[model samples]
Target: MHFDRKNYSDKILIDLYEALLRPRMIEEKMLILLRQGKISKWFSGIGQEAISIGCTYPLQDDEYILPMHRNLGVFTTRKIPYSRLFAQFQGKLSGFSNGRDRSFHFGTNDYHIVGMISHLGPQLAVADGIALANMLKKEKKATLVFTGDGGASEGDFHEALNVAAVWDLPVIFVVENNGYGLSTPSNEQFKFKSFVDKGPGYGIDAVKIDGNNVLEVYDTIRQLAENVRKNPRPVLVEAMTFRMRGHEEASGTKYVPTELMEKWAKKDPLQNYEAYLLKEKVLDEATIKKIRKAIQNDIERGLEKAYAEEMPKASTATEIADMYAPFEQKVVQPQSEGKNKKRYVDAISDGLKQSLEKYPELVIMGQDIAEYGGVFKITEGFVETFGKERIRNTPLCESAIIGIGLGMSIKKQKSVVEMQFADFVTCGFNQIVNNLAKSHYRWGQNADVVVRMPTGAGVAAGPFHSQSNEAWFFHTPGLKIVYPSNPADAKGLLCAAIEDPNPVIYFEHKFLYRSLTDDIHDDYYTTEIGKAKLVAAGENLSIITYGMGVHWAREVMESMPELSADILDLRSLLPWDKEAVAETVKKTSRVLVLHEDCMTGGIGGEISAWISEHCFEHLDAPVMREASLDTAVPFSPPLEQNFLPKGRLQQKIKDLVEF
Candidate 1:
């Protein structure tokens, strides 16, 4: 390969050498620490430093980069302090995640980098979001994202590429074909000729290059980045390399054939690059030796500083306090002078309309949500009112859209994603539970993304379409869940969820979309999350519920006026109003927790246990729970009615009140 002197000055060439050398030294030293048990684990980028260094060298500081675990050169080339990087490895308080996460699992906003979670494919969609933000702002910025050969096979990889191409997003997808994915070889991973061939299927242009040659890697990435920046379209680059070490220090490379290692050893990126630089008279042996010595000394000092740092404090209360950002629970008062009767679906539309007016950067994304106005028509005429930029339609790619929303949130751009149905959230479950739910805690990045879930069973949409799935996200930390029963609360809670800085799961009951109506206020308002609404206050017993259960409880109470029972509508499941629950339980002397989800593993079980533990002394009877039967939602309407607890709720409440 000929060195392109026109593109690289001697100074730039030497800098690239140092950039490649730094991570090599860091990994060499870290492996020793791993053996000594000072560090927990190690994922070495020993032979593949050129790929990370080369790909990152041409990027502007403002252009975002999302790197996988093996891309240590991305951190080193960005000039992250050796001390902080060492502290992160040692799990000290001085690290980026403040010891909340370990190894390359953490990301740093200061460097315009988003690190990968264990699930590697979601980051590709996240990169699409960052690229989307750049395009929306009309800035000349691009996003560089990395994935392995195995990672390319993931659904997110294909979904992200297809969407990026469809939107013409400025993203450079780099696939490092490192021969092995953990222990599995490339033969079993894919049947295609190469990742480059897979790109054309997604309507993307792709090329292949020698990843071991730093110059080739740098030139290829630089040219692609410039073209993408000017034209704003995604391109793929496949870098051929080999992983000389195991996936981690513990996972030995026994599955790899011995001859393969011997072949790759001769083609080491650092050695070959150094030999070329020497042959080109870029630098002599003395200069190379001096650079190595300096890097070693720097590593020593960094390790020493990391060793002196203290571990995170041993306090559960402190850990809990830092789990979520502080949100001001605003009190909203209803207007008494308006004739504003509205359906639940209309109220949601009003809330979204109001939110778009308030937040300039707010975007709403879902399948057929643009001119077609979504399956429920909640966004009817929204594209004309808000423009196509804000009210956008998405492909049936749930995981990619959620990851894109998260990526937009990373750049301080708020987004709202409506799952066509609550049950469909299972398709995007990994991105939700692993990425959105953990981003805030793992790093200081708030996922200001609201996921609107059309939930509950009643319309005979089948088991796949009809489900009350709030309990799925209710159990996860770093998420706020709000389920509203009527139009007023629906609109108010929707606004609140949009305004919240953390990730929020906003559950809209599909059945209540048209079935329930209220005189909702015409003006913008916000219902406080973690607050319960007191409906039909009484002294005999308390019916604690949310979503469709609120309507069922209200119906049962209306039919049986003789039983003086109060209904507590828990609007928020995660930060459920413990104060309201206690007050209501103490006042009524008996409580029944109800929900539309299946009986086992429902949110009602947690509420019932909480009441038993805290309000045991004030209770006149045992904490009772009324929920749907523990079985898949029946598609048949008659069977569905039997499966639901609504049919027997009146009798169960009567028994509890009598007992």
Candidate 2:
């Protein structure tokens, strides 16, 4: 086996041969465990050995790798310890996610591996963020991302590619064109033969290669990786391979024909590469046998050690996980001390401005965010102060931008992602609910992303542009939903959201942007989350509301000067001020919950339900909820006003008080 070291000699050939064989053996071990009921599932890279090994081996240890489920070779090539790898499969405490993720859906900061979620395309944007971090650090390190041909059809794939190419990021996207995506073949999934011709559309270099040929894949990817580091641009390499097995071991290959299966089996990467090494005299029969024996022994010992490790105790699962944590408030007095009369828009801007000054690495990204300062002028002059790098104007891809923010949040910078309009958040909803909201719970990953959503009707922006979507994320755990009432709270809460370790969906009322103005604090202070502000304290009735509803409740209370009533502005939605609501309900003996979002399934229902359960004895009347009628916001101004309960809050409050 011994040979020259300077070139691609016998020793290097044997090393490649061994690396290729290790993942195969590990999958075999996992399959046996699956049969024995020790493991649940197996996603084996049975036939795509060359594509994984060649593309991975060239990258430096510092460069991050965002791998998919079938990338067993990636873990082995990156030197992820076999003991921990087996422990993960067995759902033990010794694993990366401490049994939270029993599959290959686990990643670690230590290894710089951003593992996949079940949905394929989201990790592409995450990889983009990793490369963006590298670029920001002025490092030449490249980010390698792996996805299947089917995942290429995903929005995340397109969004990630566009950002990488547009920003000129150092990223090598290796699309393992393994003919089949789950059970669907490429013929039905894609219109193009391969993604090679598609890279130019996104301003990236493209290459197509024989995925089974280890040497060819290695040489091509190595050269591309070097060029990416030097010039810093996105490159797409489509490696054509075949899935010799089903999507998983449990999924039998009944859909695949026997002839097609036989054809790919003959062109097996490991088998072909092993023959190549033998022909090149990299190893003789004895040496090959010894290598195989050694690998088996090493795997057995690691597997034994992994099996002996303890499982995560049910009582202590969330010990290390950060979820639903309370906000820690800190007041910082301004050194110069200059207060300013500010509109709601100005307060949000100043809050962001103060946060930017506080944390220089805070990145603000969205459409029209750079020069235009957002469509509503919330971030005007932020680009000039923070520079273009910090204030990023992203393309109209909602999902990827949030995906990019998540990547940055995990890897380096604290980020605030604006949706342009709250309604458009549906485009990026998966990234928010699945990735951002679940990352902390799944793997103890910190999602320091603040999504600024401008919401509410009454601006005549119509359905697509105007809508309150707070209820969409109310059901998602690991998210902090803060909808502020006024300028002071808006600024203070934006700062607080940016500082929080978890994900915050900050809903700023579009109606309040210019309509609400007051003298705001010049210094930095975070308004406490999960706490209510007592706007007008009274004894007759209680109005519990947030966003534009808070002001409406106040207006309704003011209209009736003789009837004193308590108005509690719920600043946060997900962690709503339950204590304040209960106390006010007990004192006033009645409650009126309101919001701009539609009536059915709105957050108003959640509040009403909570109050009914907790304050049933204290209440003098059932909780009356006043939300917009269950319908899309109309374009007609008269219809829109009628659709929203802006003019009806007075009557709703009266009904609760009279009851």
Candidate 3:
């Protein structure tokens, strides 16, 4: 089709006008709602509406969109019902999130809109995965991700762009350079004059567009999206725009200079487009007035519907909470029966290999898992065995790795993501806490993903490399945490995790990786999650431990044979076996909890409190806990040993045995 600049009936121009106005009306209504206190908060796309709406013209219904908080424009232009969006603001049952998520956090699986992460930059990685999945599935869809210029400074943004470039995924990263990120302006936050400058380093095509010009954004994005779909390569589109309003309802224009604000207001995309439409005779003054009035009426009707919509009942939260609801249980037989019984690492390799054999959709990705077999060689020869298509190597982007895993999981593929070490998980905290952990709960969807991190301390690797931070995730809701203390349990739990429907954070203690010798069956086996195991039977005291602490406690038990101690290993922390712990405490009438993590807010504390509340009458002495000190793990062997819970078991044995 030849470009027709003078024709008002030109298909591209008409489409652009429709897209821009749709979001503009939504933004105007949102502002009114905010002022009336009908909506608690809102982030406006007042001036940058053209970029979001126009740039997305080429996207099909099957294509994925991972937008940021300021994407009301994109959603509105994409035909998401304004009533549903307003219901979200009111926390109603009819909202996209069913009242589980805040107003800005919206997602619709039917539309292939995965949802927005309130945190910045992480969605870039998520978009990469969606694009990668499209390529793998042989789908014609492309993935478009949007973020502000300020978000480009985040580590995840860089990580995701790099990976997408290397893999040549069908991704279009749109940077809405809307002058400011909250109160911080782009000039102050970024060192580069334009975000597109960094795209060359990642080997991706990059372009900067006049965000205020709807035609320019529409043309550029359409061409880029076409090229990306054909070649399945990544591209970066930097849309230079301006924010016409404060960041959110809570923000004020106190910090913004008056002259600068006036300049941007004069360059408003909506006003510019309105003039263009009038000058081109596409719409006369009467027609323009009619369109404005119609949009106003639509907004009013949407607001009325939203206000009348019922809020999600309290029972709804309780019902959804029932999914992760705790259950009471006594010691049950460990559920491990499989085709291959081998060491823990062997079990992992076999399970993954078997999964690949059974389901071609399974993919294993991490830093060194491809050819290096992982840091611990648990995935040794996976790349050569499974081929690069299934076993892929990722950059040193922890957040991107996990984020991609989440996206792939959402696409119905079993993705196993590994962190080089558990200590480095902090880099991916946003992906875990904000995106993966809460995705299911907030969006009423499931992310069948598995994240494995090698954890615990004993190798004198120091603070940065040697630390157990499971407590951080134990407190996080909607995440299933599993720690295996031995080879059998590790293999069994890993198998279970891969098959589960929810997100699982599987922590493999490095100290226990090859530390024990056990005869495992050669068949596939999976242990039950949310259950604890009774390793030994005793009468004096109950010792509750997990991971490497289980081994240390056992040694103490053997050393002090005079003290008959019962040992319980809690493999799962979030939905821990409270009933098992209570029963054991009640039976032994004394308890001692041990863990490798820091003492404060450790799993031991939660266990101790549960026992104290439920089995207080059965106790012979106060519940004692043995855990690492609050300080960081030391490099010196002596200091590290002293910082750990090595002597707690012996002391507990003597004290409890005497009692």
Candidate 4:
């Protein structure tokens, strides 16, 4: 409710002061490196050092942290080697991210600086997840999540706050109110005067502090962190600080007024804290000078070491790329193997049933997934089979639905989350893109979660209900995207996705749920992720498609026996089988790409490009693409049919055979 200063021993005060100053020098060196062309451009924390150091001081060595790009002070306090920091800026081998991530996107699990996401607000969800995991593990630690006032505007921020509040997860969300997001000020970004005010709405304890005062920040975070560890509830601390530099090294302050800049510079957080130390007799003038000199020397040494270090070997790049290497072997069909046969939904039911039986830690949470057995009845009889504790029905908040899943996933539990519909997924986009995709890449910890959504435009569910947005996830790294058209593949892929070591987005075709059925084995089976399935073989043309589009192509192929059309279903999008696709194209001289997404910037574009580049000589004609019209999927039957890629398979086959 109110800010209070904590009394500390003289030695502790001096150590805090030194910690606060170390990052200031490092920030300066980074800017200099950028100017000298030794490193790429970066955003400097500058005057916000006090907040970064202050929040970090209270965190225990084993506690987790999720920082934004501007928290250079936090990185220094966590003891991330300054050389690795510089190497990251230089985009070299010694970089913490191995040159995969840009400057400011560094993370280290060993230091408990769990993760850092550059795109902003999504880190909040990750912080919530880490906190939830800690609680489940019974670890006496809290997670500190840092973001700017600008990031607070994202929907994921609200979702994370609410979920953390509901679960009473041990998390402290530190909002670095640095007055500007790029050039836009906080006042222009939100209707609320302070971000702390948004916390109470989510049932989180909220407070605001004078972020320029290092001691005030230190005291606030220390108490909040301790409270979180004890009570294990979410708290929001809005630190009102100032950004004394341009948004990034590439940005100029030409748009910033001279008078305002000068005014803020006079109250620079680092200088103000130094004055406070002197006034309180906590740090003498000589000690302050010595500390500054020591920090400067350390930074210089780090820079020299970083400059001398070799770039990450090209092999390291291949290794990083190999992390998601596809499982190449063919899936052994359950029915063919003489196992008991089951439907696609039955396989999902059985897999989850087995998961519930095998792993007591696993829990199922989503809207209407418990008693109602989900809107699609995919979870039919699950609540009865697994009981309410394992099968939970959450509130009608899509963001909250995903946020809870994220939290549960972090706890090392197999959390199966379902979005009622795929089109409504925009409500939880921030969670999927920012939190899920970056969790392992940013934190070096596996989320091991599965998100199942019924997708595709059919049954005239209308614009809102019928839409395929899998392309959105396909473009995002660190997330596995699986779209299974047949019941057998759906069940098998869903099982594999659940067991994956990473977060998986499982897209189930709504049109195929009951309308189409295949003979599947009763025993559990899993299709390899990132590997495509060749449904029908032909030599003339390869019709590469996924989800409902695959079914359409199959229908067209069966109708036109004279047209030799080979069909390949790419079940997984990211880490997709480029090798298999290239090989297939080499055999078939013509290729046609199809999907349910809008034609512009659809998944087809990427696939077409890949084929054209890798198997160019194998093509008999320019790759043909058929996708839904560049418009919202219509609700009317005729319009919906007209909007989709109807009869494109026949035309593609005709062109390929004739060519």
What is the C-alpha local distance difference test score of candidate 4?
0.77
Full ranking by TM-score: 1, 2, 3, 4
- Per-residue lDDT over 449-560 for candidate 2, one digit per residue giving the tens place of the 0 to 100 score: 9999988899888888888889999988889899998998998888888888789999999888988898888988787877888888898888888888888877777888
Predict model 3's lDDT versus the native.
Answer: 0.79
lDDT of each: 0.90, 0.85, 0.79, 0.77
Whole-model alpha-carbon lDDT for candidate 1: 0.90
Reference-based TM-score of each model: 0.98, 0.96, 0.94, 0.85
Best by lDDT: 1
What does candidate 1's lDDT look like per residue over 1-659, in tens digits?
A: 45565668999899999999999989988898899998998988889998999999999987899998789999989989889999999888888887888888877889999999988999999999999988888898889999999888899998999999999999999999998899989989988778899888888899998888888899888888889999999999999999999998789889999999999999898888888899989989999999999988988888889889888776788677666766676665654556499999999999999999989999999999999999999999999998998888998899999999989987889999999998899989999899998887788788889999998888887789888888889899989999998899999999999999889999998888888888989988889989999987887899999988888998888898787778999998988999999999999899999899998999988989988998899999988889999988999999999989999898889888878
Please say which candidate is ahead in TM-score: 2 or 4. 2
Q: Model 1, which residues run further than 4 Å from truth?
A: 1-6, 331-339
How accurate locally is residue 27 in candidate 3, as Cα lDDT from 0 to 100?
73
Model 3, residue 403: C-alpha shift (Å): 1.0
